[model samples]
Target: MQRSAAISLTCLISTAVLIKSSPPEVGFTLANSVQIMALSPGDPNSYSRPDLAVVTHTNLKLSVDFDAKILRGWATLYVKKCGITDELILDHKGLNISSILNDADDTALQYVLGEAVEYGEKLSIKLPQSESSNNTYKIRIHYETSPNASALQWLQPEQTAGGDYPFLFSQCQAIHARSMVPCQDTPSVKSTYSAEIKAPANLTVLMSALREEVIESDGATNTYKFNQPVPIPIYLLAIAVGKLESRQVGPRTHVWAEAEFIEQSAYEFAETETMLKTAEDICGPYVWGIYDLLILPPSFPFGGMENPCLTFVTPTVLAGDRSLAGVVAHEISHSWTGNLVTNANFEHFWLNEGFTMFVERKIDGRMFGDKFRDFSAIAGLNSLKEAIATIGENNQLTNLVPSLIGVNPDDAFSVVPYEKGHTFLYYIEHLLGGPQVFEPFLKSYLDKFKYKSIVTSTWKEYLYEYFHDKVEVLNTIDWETWLYKPGMPPAIPAYDNALIETCKHLTKQWLQWDENTSCPFNKSDITNLTSNQRIEFLDELLLADEILSQKKLETLNEKYDFDTIKNCEIRFRWLRLCLKGRWRAKVTPALTFVTELGRMKYVRPIFRDVYAWEEVRQQAIDTFLANKDKMMYVSAYTVAKDLHLDING
Candidate 1:
């Protein structure tokens, strides 16, 4: 039941298309698979992709009304079960399976559903009673689809960031695909799938998995039939349907984007072939075929998502010419780590994200040289730190071993998985000296565990069993200090002094939430920072803590006041920072800034989207005027409704 979930840096969690029925009537403790062991079957696969999935979807038809956000479909699935079992457990999260027909007759003897869990556009139904002991069974399912609830939604009529065409999109990494469809939505339940979607003919549909065929024309609607044979976890399944265009670079290499953004996506992804080829060279081969990209309608939220062959990237990558090669490299490397070998559960999500992130640096260095690669690492660390702080909890390096699937599933997953995972791998690589030594070990690990479920312990065991001489390398490094601790480790010479300074400054500003102060600025050294530096300071100030003091906040706002008419990024940052710094105070200065920002119409969506900005601003003002005596300080206890917005309050 997965629509499409990729491990993004902000949400570093693996996803599955699982079917839950009747709330734990039947739960799979662990899903195990067996592969022919040429040598260490328990070690890992030698980088060969799973090549045997024979489920075919045909005559696949779908109808979607964007306004309603609902999808209805009927399809014929031909399954040559091989040895998979008689009753095949297909993923069907969120969708109601109206009927199941075998051949041309209704042969579904009976179906057993475990617990039904709703998430995004997917729904998971655990079927404990579908006869599958037999070698094969012909089956078909009728279903309806809808928009994923977890998606970052926007008013439909709104234009893209560039103000061209209106569009909508979703991010499905971690375990949110249950909101999209229902099925055995776990990585261990790998299967082949095909899809045919009906969409507005004017719009283009981009998908992540493989596409053996497609049929399109300028009519009332278009039919996209994708024939995929690769055995992939449900999370990698994806589709992006909207008015768009594409350009082909080479055999199996293409770029997609809205007409208005065609040039940008093409330009930014120009080096895609090189990146894909480089990754294949290092990781063995491209199992899912060639690489393609989709530059979605604005509001993609994250940089990129590695969905099998198609990597979905935000339009923001088009900002600074074609300098987005780093992101492309990261997503492409996922073809090996995240896409090929995946994490078994959300808690071990770092297995997918961290490995991909680390391999990205290696690929970038090989393709774009060392300087660009180094920058990518620094950026990864910065972004990871920001994600950890948002949760307002300690980010211990050792905690990466805990399972996310059992711990509320919601709070258990985080950027720490990817960020910390990558950091750990980077440390491992550093300990191993260079790629010459590490590449074989990585290849050997993949060779052993491909198509199998893995966790931190599995990885540790493999490391010890294969490289016993270097096993002490793990002991030397303090994994606990990194994963279980609240802050980053001390500076290593691997990064430049500038990067270290950036981490220190950002970390200090972020930790300020625990260390409150009247004025959060480092007034002593504000003069020498660059424009980017100043913006970073302001961003952290707003995000780190709640606005509590009315008078002191107003005075601080005045102290950092800037010319109201300027278009400087700093001006935008100042308005946003002040509003966040004093929303609790609900003072005149904060209210005035909110009104001015609205009137100026120059606010970034990130700020304007602040939870109930309009309502909260007015409420603060009314509350202050009405109850100035008894309640002097604005309350930081945000009702649950307000948490939906960026602000926790």
Candidate 2:
């Protein structure tokens, strides 16, 4: 759970090295290692206390400086309470709190310094002897302090010349909001917020809730006013103010990014308006005001975060010239799915991710066409298959299901939520039909659940209500099987069909290696494929082909006389298939292909057998090197070792 703008990533790599003789033991049990140490065993709800929130007045006003990192100011809160002498507690991490006063200054309020408990510097306050209930009175507190690294931190980039970056930002989701502002930092407590943030003269300050007004600066500082009238979870509250560049998309939508990333951000996020309009066309009006995208600097982790008005994205999305529109669609869809109809706990994270992913698939399919739709669908299915593979034959990983799936929100971080959940929803959409068919149902769900917290069971129940007897297909499909009992979907004819179709048409053709069998006279069957088609084919064939059939594949391998110079992709594919099958006789030829391919500078970084390309590159390099000395591809040994050093170390 990253806090909004309150933390920095630090790598603690060490020089010490250790080699294991065998694979280490691991488990699938869901563990809350961090939370267990963070909270007291007897006081599980101590960190969450909404009962302490007492309203003296219906309205409150406050102002503070973000430069200090610590929120120090006085809040004049009017209250009415009815408990003779009990202290009230406010959500504050730490501070040098000086005075607590009332409107009359008649000393109606008293200050009883409460016991300060600091779990990574979160300071809790104690209210004085005053019946906070049913009393209309004024309360004020003066404060000053420094930034808490344990809670929040900031980066003042070097672009501001001699001055420090005036803009302030926050990483408030998941529990860090308390490090920035004083509040009942829990998902249940919703209150109106009016903040006056002071920043450098020209820099802008954007917030999580909504913008009320902005007061121009007198050449030194500016005062921005925000009125958050909606009841929102504390984690959803965010603040990102910086020297950003902004551009309008369609009518009211805007794209704001770091000054350095404006042009690319604009181009990559070009589809923002289209996506927004499509979402609105499906679900009623856009509930959140103008939608915006913020491209954070490179080090920012996570592909994107769905804040109310703003979506914070990692600059890494700028790769390969705007191919990241899928992520943009994902975030934008969150405006309705995750933000409007939120999940009460991380356990129901599927409600946020699964639904948002469903929206993204629809938007991508509509905007980019069937090719993208097909690619994305297959990609999702492939990822789910991989997840099952990692779990293994004993069903060890699958057995950890209910406990690991959503029990501890953090457990849902992997492709399990994004890919498996997506596949599940994709299956749902397959049955429900496309946009024209499911629009009404989607809109109805959003309309009914807006601003409310929900869980998976509630979602499932609501879905049943919407579908009713008209959709008996739901009865045959068990949603719980996908969530609790996991493994790859049962081996059915469809799975084999997909495997065969993907292998036959999508993969590169293999060469015949047999010295005895009659070979085909024509070469057009091999020459007809495009480079991309060839690579795609190679991937499927190598991944799916069984090891026992390597002898037959090898016979076909030799007929083509595989040569890296003329067919790098096919040669590499043959080499990879040989390695995967672990066919001892084919090692010589696989080695030959690897060596020749390694010399080519234009090959994909993965095929180069060096670099972080997780799949092909690493396996290719490791295989060739192991067989280098005795195989026909002996020259590949040195290249593999060198590449491995560069990549692994």
Candidate 3:
């Protein structure tokens, strides 16, 4: 044939190829089945309609533009056809969609975005194939997130510890993933992913996936690649770029942070290897390859976020004595509970947090002692009681399984799930004749749901199935109350009363001295108590039937020098007592403390507690306003809503 004839035939064949795709040769086959056990209400936090096409693998090729504070990327989703739906819908909020294309570059897939909703907008990609010839296809979306994308936090040069280069990080939990990329942004959908991120050569890029070798650059741009061998929910997706450094803590663990904090962060999380061993011994082998941590700046709101490989943590956990390593233990426990096995949706969030808290305590027990674990649990119980009282038991948010329909999952966030969920698990262990019988079952449960998501009902079904012999005993417990009833567990857990009562006795002695004006105790009495004991003591003191007098407040502070304590946990409780007693002299220290720390765990409540006093309410508001710009979105909003102040100004 002539050259012209050959070219014409080739063009005809290319056109045919663009119209449809051949089936995927190998992949997780669930993409072909319709609705393979996603949760009810199907992830209230996301706008994506996953029933149509379930994304299995995501390839993100992006440029991190620090100058513009944007991530411009081609999010190519490899989806498996599940039903007869006309279009594939993905979740996207505050993103600028530029174009969409099929595998063959010649064909641009027609797309339309719905009016932006709170969670995000729905991106609908029209399918070209009309028959079963194509079972899978790749949809490449070229888009850039807005400067104010809620998921990405952009910090100025001065805001970072380095004081040279700007910093950027992404937090996609509780539905914020939609703001970063268009995909099935629900926990109900899990998918493996690979990322190729380009940034300035001066900075480094890290993600939730394994840190593969970094490739060379064109001029000043550096390209980094990562591979997530295990499938993860969208919320576990993460990315960070900054003047970052890393040092190995354990064999498989590395602490990634700014240069100034690398050594201390490594020291703080040194025991991660032991925690990982304990967790695996309890719940199957650790599947996700390397468990490292990213110690974020002061503005990171949460103590730690369990984001698969690189768990994002706040620098505050660097308390020199390693007292705060519990946060690391908690995040590592998520490797088995929250990350490995996940909640089906935000409503059943306890499935993630509760189980993580439980495992965290167990690991703590193994590392320290059983008494150390009880000290933590007793503290957790006090928190649970306070949380229930604050939220009001009747409010559904206090329930283990909350009804999050039409509600922001963040609004419903509380300690109820973490504490109450752990209690429920503890109750189960006790009823099943303690740890020997229960620990093995825990491993089996995690193994059964590995790489999967489940609702509260699903967890219960597995519970009964796993303990076939003890099904009758499991049934004896008040299942409805634990699963559905709001506020507190069906019955309070019996914590190791020794230390808790000791703390209470110490407080009682101090309170009696205040009342009688002849207090027998002095600061020397508490000097010997451990930090955990001090925490419990302060907590119990604050729960006194009557407020302390100004003179008594002075006496307590002078004796213990609570104002000078180094631990933030103890310092926070001491400050709260001052606010409660309206101790005027101590107010300045509270304001100073609140301004410097942006962790919501401390900032929000301290703001609210101090704001309750009319004399210094404005001061609290002023302090918050002065530092609001420095706070994370999570911290800023929680304080604003709790105090009824609009922080945007």
Q: Pick the candidate with the highest TM-score.
A: 3
**For residues 1-649, what per-residue lDDT tens digits would candidate 1 score against the true structure?**
1211211110111111121101121343432111212101111211111111223223355665676766577656444333223344433445566765664455653554334322212221222244544323345556665453442232254444345444545445544443344433445434556777777776655566566555665577777777555656656766677666789865768887767778767776777788777776678767777688887653353467788778887654564445545678889887778666776555456788788877787787787566656655665666566555555545332255442222234344445666667777767776877678888888888767654445566677788788788767767877665544555443343754452366357546544433344555543445565444555555555555455244544544454444342323455556555555544433344334333321111212222334446656455445333422211011111111123322222
- Kindly report which residue stretches of model 2 are placed more than 4 angstroms away from their true locations once superposed: 1-46, 51-153, 159-168, 188-192, 216-218, 319-321, 385-412, 431-438, 470-473, 486-649
The stretch of ten residues in a row with the least summed lDDT in candidate 3 is 32-41
- Alpha carbon lDDT at 513, candidate 2: 26
Q: What tens digits encode model 3's per-residue C-alpha lDDT throughout 139-206?
A: 88899999888888889988889899999988888878888898888776777889999999889999
lDDT of 3: 0.80
Pick the winner on TM-score between candidates 1 and 2. Answer: 1
TM-score ranking, high to low = 3, 1, 2
Q: Which stretches of candidate 3 lie over 4 Å from their true place?
A: 1-40, 130-134, 515-519, 646-649
Q: Write the per-residue lDDT of candidate 2 for residues 28-68, one digit (tens) a residue.
A: 23443433333322112124333333331212233435556
Top candidate, metric lDDT: 3
> lDDT for every model?
0.52, 0.52, 0.80
For candidate 3, the TM-score is 0.91
C-alpha lDDT (0 to 100) for residue 195 of candidate 3: 94
Number of colliding residue pairs in each model: 75, 42, 1
Q: What is the lDDT of residue 206 in candidate 1?
A: 59
